[model samples]
Target: MFLSGFYGHQAAVVRGPKQPFLMETIRVDPPKKMEVRIKILYTSICHTDLRAWKGENEAQRAYPRILGHEAVGLVESVGEGVTDLKAGDHVIPIFNGECGHCPYCTTKTTNLCQTYRVNPFKSVMENDGKCRFSTKDGEPIFHFLNTSTFTEYSVLDSACVVKIDPNSPLKKTSLLSCGVSTGVGAAWNAANVQAGSSVAIFGLGALGLAASEGARARGASKIIGGDINPGKFDKGKEMGMTHFVNPKDISKPVHQISIGKGGK
Candidate 1:
């Protein structure tokens, strides 16, 4: 099967913002224990993708790497000893897999799965913890975020593939793989927002809107949104924002807006 990937020989090399992505053909390795080969169908560009392309996150990145995190695909093959999935099963690739056996996974406090903790810059998908992708000429290429969904196919651990309904739209569901989950999790899982409580959200981007939506879904009494741009205020109001504060127009400090509400 054909696969897609990008390579950067040099770090911090500014390719124009509108630079077109280059595609390459490569062979995918067979999955090892608890691993699966996925035939990717849909992937999306997130802020992280932009940051990586601009080399803004170079410190945590490696050269000649494949970059992608959000994805949805179908299982094309499974590794030995894998039981829960088989070929043809539909799945979503979780950028961060949760190893149920780990203390952090057991607590379910966050998606930071313990067993998969390998430095992306220095590691690839080798069973012995080494690089997996290499050029025909033998130069190694690093795997980005494990999922590498930009490719038409991906090899991922079973922990990273969550089975979902087969009939679900792959393109739309792909969003839930990262952006949707991150935004929702930050509100319910991280902040633990309570129902009928008053809450104020900063920034009105996708994350902020998701937070506001979560609060509204949780029965929050009031949701105040703060943004430097007044243009976003109208959209924020449409998304259940009870109050919109333009930081520039305020006479007093922004912190005072939350005054007497027990906030610092």
Candidate 2:
């Protein structure tokens, strides 16, 4: 019912493939039902954002769009039916949201919500299949993923936001919104990495480094990092990795080496 208070804010907008981002003033609509408005305090650009920025896939392209996902912010306002959070709460926007009562969320097999799975093609709000951002002249701007944080202000489904302890550092906490979480979640949950177990990870970039950190936290005795670039070896060691394997230098695949087949 509250659709009257729209505030003007600046956002980086991309209109075409490989185009420069335009700084445009857009009006962000107040949250609708089960939504929340956030005043972004910190944001991080991820590889996913880079891919979307390139508009790599023609079919997935949506012009005049706001693209971002990893960020930390404060809850500016809560929409109808949002009782768990209030204004001034610290939060991080999650691209993959969980609608607590959904069948998938309730099952032990997975945590993917039935309706809020990450969809590159979904450029609108879940509540009304419409855009919450628009040009000052009223032209609609598309949203990227479920959480768009490339602006000073953003609106997202309440489920997409996780309230955190106000004491947490918003800048560092933003990592949990995407890259760090993706890697750690994979190593901890999907892989079920156990204490004292040996672990091998390929491609030691930010994601791999995060996985190494997770493995280290689990008491992994041997954290072997694999990457074509030797430059990452130093950083990998800093993350508790015990060894580095460059697949290009060896005749055998890194996986085969991990399995005990010696690589040259």
**Which candidate leads the pack in TM-score?**
2
Cα lDDT for residue 50, candidate 1 = 73
Let me know the TM-score candidate 2 reaches against the reference structure. 0.92
Tell me the lDDT of candidate 2.
0.88
The sequence of per-residue lDDT tens digits that candidate 1 reaches over residues 1-264 is: 222333322121122332555565554556777778887888887887777666664576566666777888899888877899989999998767776777777785436666664334533763556554555566665666667777777778788789999889877898887777776677787778788777788899877887887888777777888889888887887778887776777565545554434221
Identify the candidate with maximal lDDT: 2
lDDT of 1 at 6: 35
Which residue pairs clash in candidate 2? Answer: none
Q: lDDT value for candidate 1?
A: 0.70
| Reference-based lDDT, residue 168, model 1 | 94
Where is the poorest 10-residue window by lDDT in model 2? 255-264
Model 2, residue 218: distance off in Å is 2.1
